[model samples]
Target: MTYELTRDRVEHYFDRTATKVWERLTSDAPVSRIRETVRKGRAQMRDKLLSALPADLNGVRVLDAGCGAGQMTHELAMRGADVVAVDISPSLVKIAADRLPNTLKPRVTFASGDMLSADHGAFDHVIAMDSLIYYTEDDIRRALDNLGARTSGSVAFTVAPRTPLLMGMWYAGKAFPKSDRSPTMIPHGPSRLRKTVSDIGQLNDLGRVNSGFYISQALEFRP
Candidate 1:
């Protein structure tokens, strides 16, 4: 599938799954065992992402690119950062906006749009979380270029590892078929991802969390 089509599918899937995604982000008690596992895995990924942020976010400006359900966006605002949270799914964006506390509403600006094309102005930090898993290598490079232009300090994102074992698992999922509505993911290994961001800034490997079949690799780039 084309990148645009894949992105559309991802947006649709997330929009449909917005409520479940919110629960997964906030609550540990998922409806099913599989969902419980997913919750644990995503929590680990969030922790790794949070660890890479600046120690002091007081008055910091942040671009929460692809900020699904405002999970990280809320955290950033709580840390005293002024956040511009952007997501492609309108439903998810609305959910995120509604979930924000009344006091934090003033500190956050929620919008629905493609992160690469949006003009969110400048920020001290740009975080994409687990959102880049749908982008191809070229698309990822383009996104990094856009993010680098807006960020003055650092950019952080997560990608699914492209290892043989993980690729096998992905193929197995396609064979078994969980649901016909699942979104297509484009996995990128650490080496290729490092090269994609090298032109824009210095790449730092934050760490990787192995979540059974796939691995979530956290990376930060400093300009």
Candidate 2:
């Protein structure tokens, strides 16, 4: 099935799978080999993102752009940072909001909107997580510019790396029956992404996590 990358479709895709997405990110027990691989890769990505954060986040202002289900949002808040979490899917935002602990409620504000257009105000740091995979190269650049403009410290994000093997796997996954692939899973190269953020900050290649056929790269931009 050919999947069209439309706003409505993207929202629908995530909205219906918000719970599953949350489980995939937070689950510790894997029922199958595929699940284990996915869990390990996601954990590595989350670790890389967290490691890039400042050593001291007490009272820090953070923007969790495209914070689907708010896993990182919760983590940041737990570290004593006030977090403004935003997502394009209303259901996902709701899921994130509901998942927050009562004490952390005051530290987090959940908003439903596109990160590229949302005015989340200034923040000490910003994290986009696995969100940029849904955007085109030009749009990703614009999003990076917007995020950079609102942060004083750094901006961290993950992307589906563009490589012959990964590109082939992406296509194969799309061609499979009943595939749960996102319509906007466009792969990007690290060099091209660096050029896009060149004017905003200095790019640091954090590293990459391999999950069988797929690879997710983590990058940080210091202003």
Candidate 3:
């Protein structure tokens, strides 16, 4: 599928189907054991993504692409980075803006749009956690190309690594009715992804995190 088509599906899934559940899942509210594991996994992934960046972020400009509910975005601003947190879901973006601490407001600009939009301008770094997992490898590379062009430092992103467990889950989830399914994650082989971005920049294997059903590999690209 083309990027725009995939983006439309993603937007519809997040905005119409999963917004409330996603908001709850990302919050402190009680959830089922399965969902709790997902929450834990996401937290680990966030930390892994953040650890790739510099310790001191004062005066730094960062892009929080697909900044769902703004957890990572808040963290970046807390560390003193000027953040433009963009997401495909307007509902989630609103929640992110509303949930942001007042003190951090001056450091963040929240918007509901394509994360790769050039209007958001340049950045010192970019973090795209759980954002590019749905795209094909080619689309992911295209996204990195656009993001890398605007970033002076590096871009940290995540992908749903193709593994036995994840592949099984993907197949099982396929049994669900189309009406009930959320946006499906396109699992990627690490080597293929790494090699595909060869000309974009220097790619680093940052490591992977697995917490129950949530599994993702983190990578950093420096230009």
Q: Compose the digit string of candidate 2's lDDT tens values, residues 58-167.
A: 88999898788778888898889989999878877887888789999999999997665646789898888888776677777776777777788888998898878868
Error of 2 at 64 (Å): 1.0
Kindly give the number of clashing pairs for every candidate. 0, 0, 0
Model 3 quality (TM-score) = 0.96
- Best model per lDDT: 3
CA displacement after TM-score superposition, residue 214 of candidate 2 (Å): 5.2
Candidate 2 global TM-score: 0.85
Error of 1 at 167 (Å): 0.5
Best model per TM-score: 3
- Inter-residue clash pairs, candidate 3: none
Candidate 1 lands at a TM-score of 0.87
lDDT of 3 by residue, 1-223 (tens): 7999989999999998899999999899999999999999999989998998898899999999999998999899999999999999999999999999999999999999999999999999999999999899999999989989999999999999889988988889879986688778889987887799888877888999999878899988886
lDDT of each: 0.79, 0.78, 0.92
What does candidate 1's lDDT look like per residue over 134-208, in tens digits? 778888777788788878888889887777776776777667554564765667777877777677778788888
Which segments of model 1 are wrong by more than 4 Å?
17-29, 173-179, 212-214
